[model samples]
Target: MNPNDRSIVALVMTGHGLVHTYELSIPIFMTAWLGELGVSEAALGAVVGAGYFLFGAGALPGGVLVDRFGSRRLIAGCFVGMGGAFVLLGLLPGLWGLGAALLAWGAAASVYHPAGLALISTGVQQRGRALAYHGIAGNVGIAGGPLATALLLLAFDWPTVAVLLGLPALLAAVGAWRTSFDERAAVGVHDAPDAGHGEPSPRPDDRAALWTRSKALFASGFAGVFVLVALSGLYYRGMLTFLPDLLTPLVTVDLPIDVAAGRYVYAGLLAVGIAGQYVGGRLSDHARTEWALAGALAVLAAVAVVFLPVAGVGTAALLAVSAVLGFFLFLVQPLYQATVAEYTPPEARGLSYGYTYLAIFGVGAAGAAGAGGLLQIAGPPLLFGALAGLALLGASLSGGLAVRRARVGTHP
Candidate 1:
């Protein structure tokens, strides 16, 4: 790859890492908030769910903004907003304040996926490899964020840790502002027709154009992919939201050394996703993305079905099972991302990603509340079973999409 490609990948990966760092760290803080604020787990989950809902909800508009303004501008703004929100989180001193801070952070963080992934799809040459590297960076943040937050909790309080965590966003904002890239080259369109150069330009009608594009996308069978992603989102959020709490009871063996056992195990499980992302990304490049997605979801369904019983055996067995679960959990990400790109036109890539994330994150945010409710009422077995069902549903949708694509003999 060229130097420009490398730079683009690096910038997008950095933003991806920062976004997940803030996102995944929230769960670690949730445990602290429960004790300090004296709130029920359900109440705390509601607050977190609100933030996640905003995160997903904002993505479609954020994509529109990225398409209009350019990805670099939106990404830089995201970092600034996220950083400021975290600073407020540190300074504020009440549950209400915390809720406000999280809401603000979610709004800010929502821009990253649409902007970063759109940037990658447009700017990079080795799209698959770039996406693989991007997934790796995200998994790194997923694993490291919790581990770092857990270690920080051992020393400093949650507020102080939050303040420290906000620092990277500040740094990343500066990096984004200073870095230069050609948006026209990436998207293969000029922002405006060159009036000075006597170029013929059509009168702009933003709303009509956006609606027309969206209508075409849905009519072209993007709806099936959207449903598949939504199901994936539901399963992803439902299983992950309570994983740490779920695992707490299953660990029966003592560690060789003293550690925050739940946190350590949580981090280890997510760390394994890095390898999964690498494999998934690689496969998406070489194999059919829909087929890859269908296969991954099938395995994920099987894993979720067996998770409860295997988790009961012993610490080693539980950890091993958790590792397998983690592998399939993240492996579907790149496949779906690549599939979205395949199904959409180049000009509308940003908007396509916007709707994709809306399904994955916005509609998917219900998983947190749903999982929390199940844990409180039905318990782990039912929860795992529900997740397995969701995965199967997602796999069925993906398989249908694959069949449709084969029948049409074109990318859908």
Candidate 2:
């Protein structure tokens, strides 16, 4: 890719990363918010879960807008919407107000997957690596959200902290407004002998082509991939949402120390996954895509077996297992996302990514709610067991997809 392409990728990534940090502030500051608002635990959980559900629900329509309008405009709108949502949340009064604010946040957050992924697909030539960098930016944002919330909460109340979260989105909105990219614009409609350089053609009647290719892939093995990704999403949300809660009690340290230390430890572990994303990206750029995904799944399976059994595992051991788990789990995200990019035509990139992320966010929402219920009943052992089972099934499903993808390549 040239300097201009690189510059565009960076801008899109910055916007995406900033958007995530703002969207996630609610979960990061949930405890503090609940204390200030005097809400019950169950109510807080429900509200947070609703935010995730709304975020997923909005993705399909967000994709439609991305397809109709352009990534740049959609992304710019997302930034403004998310910033406005956070500002609303900061100024709102009660639990009802919180719910309304989260609804807006979810709707705004939904714009990222379609807009950001479409930007990378259209603006960059080697999309695999570009997508990986995008994933890295997201993970970095994920890590930063809690860290920022933690720091801000110390100085300001939940409302002020929320208002502060809006700053990044406001800045990103400005940046996104200035950029432009259109897949059809870059590659014109031209009929010629195979451009032996091996690039997917820009489809004529772009929207119709998008529908055709996306529908075909959905009917083919793509459905199976969606199931695997949904399960992967559930496992991730279940594990991350509950892991610290589960581990904190087992720690012999003070409450403040345990929560504080655990948060950073988990964030550090998650940071390792950035490497995983980059590795998957580089491998997908050249190798069969499934290999990178399979590697991640296999590692996650092994991590589950070792880490899930012991409830009171020491800090050092927890750190080690968490790092490996994070590496495998968070890393597979880009690989799955890139699969949508590689399989569909460029015109459908936005819709394909939209549906993929919809599955991810939807499953994650269910996992978040169901995990809370399960934790109450069977405790962490059963919960981890169930998640591990889901991971195992996802692995089997991914293996099947890989074999089928290989066969299609050989015969075609």
Candidate 3:
């Protein structure tokens, strides 16, 4: 990336990583919540699901804010909000506390995707490479969060660790406010804010205009992508919500120093996902995004279908399956992100991403509660089966999207 694009990616990278750091940390904390608070997995999952739902649901308005204001302000606000939410977690330390903290974090975090993706898509010249880097940073946080939380728990208590986790974002808030970059560097002259003579950017503040903008957005074949995103989100949420706890039993074996076996494995799985994200992002720039994403989802479905059988095998086989699952789980993200860019115009990128994440984390967050209930009633086998079904549906939608675009000669 050139200097300007580097700056934009850096800002989004930092903010994105921190967001997932707090996000994935919740499950690690869930282990402690289960031990200390005496809450059932089903109840815990539901509460956590509520927060994640808001995280996605808030993206719609956040997209509007991104278009109206710009990414920088919203991101700085996100940093402050997430930091404050974690601080609340430290202070409260109860079931109700978890719910409240998560909701706060969700609201604060809701703007990030719209803000970050809009910034990158519009501001950065090299959108694909920038997204790859962004996805890698997120995987870092996704892996790092659980690993850090697990390690910290070995020394300090959960509350102290929570506060410590909160501090970094507080510091980042200052960095965000101080950082400098352009919001429309890559935009055409017509889309540039300072353009003297061109089509003015849409201000969808009025109800009729807002409705028109939204209607045109989904009608642009983004609706197919939305279905895929919702399925992907559902599978992601359901699979990860109780995965560490679920894997804890299967992965139990001798280790030098004591550790949460499942947490470390989960972290390792996500660490492996870093490569997946990279591959997906690079492929998005070259391959057909819909087709590539469909292949990834198919592989993901196979992994989910065989996950339980793999778990029954030796530890090595279980770990191998986990590594593959994690890889494909995240691999589709950048592809879908790129797909969104293909379907939407630059002027509407914010709203497009808003709806995108809303599908992924908001509506899809039901997977958490659904997984918990399934785990309680049937077990891992049935839960994995349902997850496989979600992946299959996503794969079909993505393939259908590819076929439709090809037939219409819009496969760019």
Predicted model with the maximum TM-score = 3
Q: What lDDT score belongs to each candidate, Candidate 1 first?
A: 0.79, 0.68, 0.84
Q: What TM-score would every model get versus the actual structure?
A: 0.86, 0.80, 0.88
For candidate 2, the per-residue lDDT at 384 reads: 74
Model 3 clashing residue pairs (backbone) = none
Per-residue lDDT of 269-308 in model 2, one digit per residue for the tens? 5667777766765666776666667667776766766685
**Which residue runs of candidate 2 sit more than 4 Å off their true CA positions?**
1-10, 33-43, 120-136, 174-214, 253-260, 282-295, 305-311, 338-350, 403-412
Off by over 4 Å in 1: 1-10, 117-135, 175-205, 255-260, 345-347, 407-412
- Worst ten in a row by lDDT for model 3: 191-200
* Local accuracy of candidate 3 as per-residue lDDT tens digits, 34-92: 77889887888899999999998987788678878898999999999999999899899
Q: Which tens-of-lDDT digit does each residue in 254-350 have in candidate 1?
A: 7675544666677788888878877887898799889889999999999999887888888888999999988888888878878887786655655
Estimate candidate 3's alpha-carbon lDDT, on a 0 to 1 scale: 0.84
lDDT of 3 at 382: 88
